[model samples]
Target: MPGFSFETAERTHVGCVRKLNEDRVLSRPEVGLWAVADGMGGHQAGDLASSMIVDALSSIELLGTGYAFLDEVQESVQRVNRTLVSHARLSRPGTVIGSTLVALLIYDGHFACLWAGDSRVYLLRDGRLNQITRDHSMVQELIDSGALQRADAPYYGRSNVITRAVGVNDRLALDIASGPIQEGDVFLLCSDGLTGMMDDDEIEAVLKARTADDAADHLLKVTLDRGAKDNVSLVLVHVEPSVDDTLRTARRTLLA
Candidate 1:
């Protein structure tokens, strides 16, 4: 498989209502990797936890034939979880630190995603938006169990309560999946900050704009304008069909 470079940009904001931003994001353009994380614990613990996850994942390299992308990601996440748990115990007693992680890993004309909690990844192609990640929250669980209607998810109580998150439990349940990519395709990795404030339609409209940087900035701005109740983070990536030899070699070595 050949290697490709991703053109990307990211932006995060405290928003109109939040006193401090707890969202964190990281991107590796050479590897075509990106991630968005939203912290759950109160105080600055959430911010620290989210940053640790990004830092851990950003260093991981996924490459080669039959490479273990999912395993590597899970390991990195676990390390971050441990770090968060240790920090919580030492610095902030009784402060449970956890976060939702949504990431994109581009490889060989396709991409794999690892998602947990309520953060999401959306695909934009041909002027349309399709949500690619499912939320792991109480509302989604009810929908799965036939206890709640899908259409009523927006207004459902406990909608913000996430079912799965890093550092929340000893073992985490993550939703992992893969899909094909196309030229001119745009991918969005965002926290609940944007999705909770703006619907899918609004996000698609802003993403279909001129460039990745513009899209990411606009998304954050729009969320804040709409009364961002929490810290907002967004990462926009445009994948093209071109390949880079250096990137391919690095990924190959990582796998080896």
Candidate 2:
């Protein structure tokens, strides 16, 4: 990934029903970091929680790559977690302000996905679409436990319940997954607002678009068309070899 470059597109929509769009997206390809955070709707100051996450991640300065970069990201998220928890303690007894975080980090030739709650990171490679980050929602737990069928997940009554989040607990337990990055691989980071409106197949069809901008526009359009009931947000990143890297690859091929 060091020799490659990325093209990214991001979109946030309030949807048709929500009065406020409590979703935040960060796209910093320069730093090889991108994220999406969905504020828990109906909770106190959901928008504020999401914005704080974006601001925290924006402050990250890449001192090094790999685990060092990951450490910086994790610490920033944890710092925000502490802030939100302290603020809630000073507020009313039932006040809870939190947001789900899903961040994609690329460095060297590897990629890392860090997440808490249901925000997702997906990968599209070799014409196959794969969900890289697993959801921490009640519906997903039910499916995993065999208490609910995967097909019934959409209709599950407690679909909004999330087990892990950035600020709900004093010690935030973030989940991480890492793998090598492949040229031509495409990554998608999104809030549940987008997923709640569209299915994986519908998303795959949209991702098939030729450009990141087109894919983002078309995806948001479809969400609105389907009567989006929650705030929707997404960031699409396309990986391509840099010109110098491409020439080097070509030279290697010729030599071979």
Winning model by TM-score: 2
Model 1 lDDT, full chain set: 0.82
What is the alpha-carbon lDDT for the whole of candidate 2? 0.90
Instruction: Give the clashing residue pairs of candidate 2, or none.
Output: none
Question: Against the unseen true structure, what C-alpha lDDT does each candidate score?
Answer: 0.82, 0.90
For model 1, state the Cα shift of residue 214 in Å. Answer: 1.8
Model 2: residues with Cα > 4 Å off, grouped in runs: 41-44, 247-256
TM of each candidate vs. truth = 0.86, 0.94
Error of 2 at 108 (Å): 0.6
Q: For residues 107-199, write the lDDT of model 2, one tens digit per residue.
A: 988899999999999999987889999999888888998999999888888888999998888999999999999888899999888888889
lDDT at residue 35 of model 2 (Cα atoms) = 98
What does candidate 1 score in Cα RMSD to the true structure?
A: 6.2
